[model samples]
Target chain A: MAQRTLLNQLIEALRCLPGVGPKSAQRIAFHLLERDREGGSRLARVMAEAMTRIGRCRRCRTLSEHELCGLCANPNRDPGLLCVVEQPSEIVAIEQATDYRGQYFVLGGRLSPLDGIGPEDLGLGLLEERLREGLVSEVILAISPTVEGSVTAQYIAECAAQGNVKVTRIAHGVPLGGELEYVDGGTLALAFTGRRAL
Target chain B: MAQRTLLNQLIEALRCLPGVGPKSAQRIAFHLLERDREGGSRLARVMAEAMTRIGRCRRCRTLSEHELCGLCANPNRDPGLLCVVEQPSEIVAIEQATDYRGQYFVLGGRLSPLDGIGPEDLGLGLLEERLREGLVSEVILAISPTVEGSVTAQYIAECAAQGNVKVTRIAHGVPLGGELEYVDGGTLALAFTGRRAL
Candidate 1:
């Protein structure tokens, strides 16, 4: 191990990022110190600011610098349609690929009895309150299509129906550009069951 | 686009790392804000400290928090055999792979005339001065095996000879665990030419 304490601490801290391991962390730490000091300094300042100032949006539970996130505050987006996701990152993925112009609700986590995460933990109470307002006509469940995810979605659908709102879920099938041979049986079955008239 | 200015700026700054593009940067930024605020804060502080305090070692030109790096300051390591490398990262690679206990000289970059790098830019004068001290009996070139790397190694070898010091280079061939079928022709040729008797 290198005898530099502070440098080692920096490397260890970088490993906390998703997919970053010891080797990648070391490379990033060295690159910042040796070649990209200005960029590193900027990253430091922005990260500090984002960490201290950013918080969950009151409406969606997504991390943002304000009480209401940009998507929640934008009037151009459809208030009649709401998309629900398990994590804030999922919101970005949908936004990048889809033309969905609706508001979002971040569940933050899915129902998992093993993990002790239930509707209350996901702030489903807040979701029910918003649905009861009668402004939203449809609720789209965009959570992952896992077993726990299905349970969570079903529970949410029941909650949405109580408010007289139509409930739907995002489709699960063989991914675009994927070969049928490599697609899992469960996904193929879902694709067959959800086939649309062409 | 996420319209939170501070969050977006954090993502942009994270893209400065090697192998990190827009998507990875965004994921990292979101992960920090959403899941690991304590880790993110510590990362920011360490990055600021490293950016401000770390500098090139006065003796070896490697990154360090002091005038002399750990290797340079150690009294027990052999100063008679010096290893030369392109960057500070290479020092780590060599240290991890080999038990070579010797001093080092960091060229910081390879010789590439098209890239406007020359002997002066590489601090060849400093290397020459060290060799002229006459304590060193051998200088090992650990530069990469590329055209520019070869040119740089040859120039350093010539410079080392002026001080009556023996110059050698690390062997380049099929890697220890590489399959012969997958080895490239240029490397296979070098392997064939450099074969040794049992």
Candidate 2:
């Protein structure tokens, strides 16, 4: 059957991408075949290498190919300030947007008991070990503002307290350049409460 | 630099896809790495195979791993009825939307001289050879109604005329579910001119 052709299989496989659907998958397959075989081949090579080689960093739990991620291995970055995030992708976001040179610890996800995720799954024991190391002076929580996120932040704060380390959370409020009238009520209220003295 | 990480390379390579950008590429790489590594590995294998192995069918110019495509190899399909389309992707669309169990010929693209595309570039000589064989009793043009498409259709019709084969074109008018008020003026005019007795 033409249904089992390699072209069809490629199209089907491309749907594994986050946003690609059946139609887009077909388009991508045909486009690669017709216009950009070189690019398609490059993507395949890089993707295969990444899938098989990349693993969680032992020190911080971010995706890496080595025992420790580049940030964790670099002595130039401050070891006294730790920024905690829910995912490795968020580490990339924070790096691109901010000048913070502190080391990072990835939770992978928040405390979602209904989904069977807990502190153990997030390697909280390792985080506690890092907290007890006495190197970190402050822990910054960059987790999203949700019920599970708050709970996760609270748990990490308690861990920091045990180690005599100060704990703080990134602020939550209406985004910069967002019109106050168009802002959602929850965000607007947060903005009001988070207002600065300036 | 962390910028040269394997994860980052995978994200950069993913941007080669048609619609993906920096943000979406990052999301796709992370999603595959974190959640669907199996699917990602499968995609890499299949995509590499397809890019290197899938070549155009000798009979119809559609993508195939063998000398002839599945439709060309199938004896049940009628060889006498030839449906011509501008792309291999359109062959899939027609196969899904209609039950026309006939052979197909891919033009690959319409005749756009300014873009260096011509009848010879579309393998029209091969199509003329098929027409001259007299095995095809009818030729159906399923190309779009663009200026270049019309020119291509006219050229193919002339080629069919030489072999005394019946030539027909799919009707161009208001789309099946289109509202009359919203139909474009050109399409409305075509609908009037191509009205059926029923």
Candidate 3:
């Protein structure tokens, strides 16, 4: 057996990236070695630091280098309005696309009993404690409309109700720029059922 | 102004990868942090070492940590048949898909005078010296059929002619398993002109 070179090792390691297959990994490796050595070096340094240093924010459970994420630490953000999401990336998506000025709670994933993801796994007990603290006026569900997501949202809504906090969900329907014909049946039905007087 | 977190910095740095835009960078960062920290750390360490240590092979100009690339150092490879390619990745492609056992020379790129690339820049002088040493009996051009590729191939063929060595090129045509209707015009024309006795 021929010894694998450093070039081969770099290519193999690059396969760890999501969506990068064998061909793409090889291409990325050669591209870095040939044209972007500086970029590759910087990526290595930053990636190493991020892998070791980043931990979940104690308050919101979002990825952060410190105890609290920047959003959780910000006094300007509304503590009275808590938005719940399934993943940290969803927080980024909401932040980029919307003007919502509220605090967030990351569930990490939807509740699935077969997968053993209980309320404790999602830190729901901590969320209930925050709700019981009495600062929160409203709890918003930005979770997906899947069965597991619905169960998770329902469970959280009940927890908020016990604390006498109002609960609402972000509207789900045909997206803003979507054509009605192209929208899926479930979304179109939701759009019709949720329609208000015009 | 809010301070950028290490997570954001990691996302930004990840964009340096070819074909990875903002969304993909964000996805990869989150994926590594959430699911594959071990793979991410290994990638970082290997990537750093490869970037800092790997250099061009003295003989073939292919990427290597040692002075000579593995293929160049291998005693089993035929020194009499020199196969020239435009990039180091092309060498890997040929090695995987073909059974031809011969020496390889990576030109790094074809002669693009508009981009200030010349013969010396491609290590063509070293190639010429090797041909003149009387050991190599055949020189094979596996370069692309672009205008610059043709010019480079023609120049190398002339160098071999001057040394009284046999020169050949890899055939270009509709690829194996390609449909005739989908094959492009230039390639179809080449296929017709290069048709062999069957």
What's the TM-score of each model vs. the native? 0.92, 0.96, 0.96
Total clashing pairs in model 3: 0
RMSD score of candidate 1 (Å): 2.2
Instruction: Report how far residue B97 has shifted in candidate 3, in Å.
Output: 0.7
Model 1 CAPRI quality: medium
Question: Across residues B1-198, which tens digit of lDDT does each residue of candidate 1 receive?
Answer: 455467788888888888899999998888888779999998888888888988888888888888888888888789999999999888888988899999999998989999999998898888999899888899999998889999999998898877789999899899989999999999999899889899
Where does candidate 2 chain A have its weakest 10-residue lDDT segment? A1-10
* Tens digit per residue, CA lDDT, model 3, B1-198: 144799989999999999999989999999999999999999999999999999988988888999999999999999999999999999989999999898999999999999999999999998999899898999999999989999999999999999999999999999989999999999999999999998
Q: How do the residues A1-198 of candidate 2 rate in per-residue lDDT, one tens digit apiece? A: 557889989989998988789999999999999999999999999999999999999999999988888999999999999999999999989999999999999999999999999899988999999999999999999998889998999999999998899999999998889998999998888788888898
Report the Cα lDDT for residue A192, model 2: 88
- Count of steric clashes across candidates, in order: 0, 0, 0
For candidate 1 chain A, which ten residues in a row score worst on lDDT? Answer: A1-10
Lowest summed-lDDT stretch of 10 residues in model 1 chain B?
A: B1-10
Task: Put down candidate 1 lDDT per residue, A106-125, tens digits, no spaces.
Answer: 99888998999978899999
Off by over 4 Å in 1: A196-198, B1-4
Return the TM-score for candidate 1, rounded to 2 decimals.
Answer: 0.92
Q: How many backbone clashes does candidate 1 have?
A: 0
